[model samples]
Target: MGVTDEVLTEEHKIEIRRYFYNHQNADGGWGLHIEGHSVMFCTVLTYVSLRLLGESSADGDGAMRNARSWIIDRGGATFIPSWGKFWLSVLGVYEWDGNNPLLPELWLLPYILPIHPGHWNSARDQCAKEDLYFPHTRVHEILSSSLHNVVEPLLKKWPLSKLRDRALTMVMDHIHHEDTSTHYLCLGPLNKVLNMICCWVENPNSKAVKCHLARIKDYLWVAEDGMKMKGYNGTQLWDTAFSVQAIVASNLPNEYGRS
Candidate 1:
């Protein structure tokens, strides 16, 4: 869903084109959401999305041209955030080294350690990961603080080593478990795309890729403007809670003498 790897069908392409065109700002760029201001993250993703949907950069309207200029003014796609870089890498539009390490082995950390993921609040863990991805010597500082990072360079140099292979096997198994447990839905669209890519890389002929592809439609939504990817399949529980609150506030039960 987040810069999906799946090839879009002609109908899917049409709907996505409508969605992008409808959402583009007067400045010929996009924001993180419909009402949000234009930012590099959103702009880059939307620009790539349009290209993926078959919009050429040479279009007469100059939408892509304007976006390219805007992105260049902001230091181009290289300035995109970690998640953006990750998606671009999967799309083969960007190099993976631009992203700080997101070693799946981090999930293998012992729970008893103070730095264990189980000990982290979501926000803290997120910040920690972002800090890990920072581009400067700060990345070195962050990596030096983690034992896993300390060994990552050594592992990379010995790609054919038994230890590295075993570690990768473990990571792949963890990924598969995550996919199976989530019913191939993943934590959200971003993770779903990453998981699908990971599975494909590990074994293109594997069932994992088939399952992820099969469920791709779950993340899409058809709106009045056109089709767009939802953050999740549905927020049924959230909507239900709001509906109940609205019903309670209307005093309909009192009017019916139910109270």
Candidate 2:
């Protein structure tokens, strides 16, 4: 976590690149999930990841070339969904200012408040058409416009800016608490990665960042295709319970089961 290139070992990087290549859609892009159709959201992110791993635009046996073509045909990374944009921005390829304000102050509100983070929708409704699950409502459009045009500018000024700083402190406190409580794995793969990023940003050499790095292997799974992040750390209790029930129903011999 201290340095970008040192995060993954050489072997780890090779397998990660293999996973992307093996899962590429016939159209030379990737899907939002495994075995799904290629979408801008997945395609652009995968392409950027390949580049970060030292693949040129021409690498991957023409796979990278075709991926670029797919993105170009769909208006490049500009149409990638907000999730992809966030990753790209963190990687320094996309402009952070291009994104709508995600007010950290929202985390400061009471849980009982309707404006609390649980229901907060700070970003605009923009996303690649392929990834759009629901159409944007008029109310959402108005809210996005208001935040982008009015609220964001005002928040940059005196008193409101101080509030943002305080809110950030509160957010980091929560993140650290969650990391220590969960032994640095957090809730799931997504939150684990997010929490790790926050820790790295806060202090790359801090104990929290080191603990997060130690727990990373918990999320990795090696399949026939390649290694990939599991949906969560593991469902050990759930899997064990079901497996025991099945073995009992089968009336497996005690010696055979024990063996």
Candidate 3:
């Protein structure tokens, strides 16, 4: 529903549109959660999602116009966080240069190295890449000088080139391994969408793309009001365990003792 090409069903699109329309705030924006204040991150993504799902920008009530004004007032999409930049890039709504580099090859570092993922205390630390922009320089210029930019131009300049093929192959293999290990769910909704885009860009016909499309259904949740994308697959197991503990703590087990 959110600009996913050929991967979303008609039912999904209808439900997603219903969810967005139902949740739009009085100010014509959205928030990070149902009860939260409107934020640029949530507002922009939801607005784009609705547009992609066939909603008109020129609707009579000025819903889309109001959301656009909100985004512009908040310094626009470029000011959105890294994850927002990533999704917008995939959707072709934002330039990839706006984002800090996210190199999958970072995982290829030797395990004994101090910078290896296993050596980091937090997952965030393990994935942190350089923030390459300076206050004076333009983002495009900074990105043009990046290693990815340098190598990408060379690859484009020479088709079928073998220069970085070996290293690039290793990175691609690691991506595939991750897709398999996580069953295409990845770490969360953002990561899942990014990985799907990566797989599609790399090889639309690859098994990885198929796996991602097949498993995406797990992240959707339907409710009486409407439907929405979930942070992850259902939390039934976690909720059930917590419920059992809470019940025990309430001393309700004695009142409802097993026969």
Which candidate should be chosen as best, given lDDT against the real structure?
Answer: 2
Model 1, residue 136: C-alpha shift (Å): 41
| Sort by lDDT, top down from the best | 2, 1, 3
Q: Worst ten-residue run, lDDT, model 1?
A: 120-129
Query: lDDT per model, in order?
Result: 0.80, 0.86, 0.77
State the RMSD for candidate 3: 13.3
Candidate 3 on 79-132: residue-level lDDT in tens? 777888899999898987888986778789887787665654233212223653
What residue pairs clash in candidate 3, if any at all? none
TM-score of 3: 0.47
Top-TM-score structure, candidate number: 2
Query: Which ranges in model 3 have alpha carbons more than 4 Å from their true place?
Result: 1-7, 103-224, 228-259
Candidate 2, residues 1-259, lDDT tens digits: the string is: 2366666877777888898999999998999888899999989989988888889999999999999999999998989988888888998889998777899998888888977877544444658889988888889888878988899888888989998788889999999999889898888879988999998998999998889888988888778888887898778878888988887888875845574
lDDT of 1 by residue, 50-109 (tens): 887778997527778988888998888999888899999999989877889867776799
Q: Model 2: residues >4 Å from true position, as ranges?
A: 101-212, 230-259
Model 2 lDDT at residue 136: 84
lDDT of model 1 at position 193: 95
Q: What is the lDDT of residue 130 in candidate 1?
A: 50
In angstroms, the error of model 2 at 44 is: 0.6
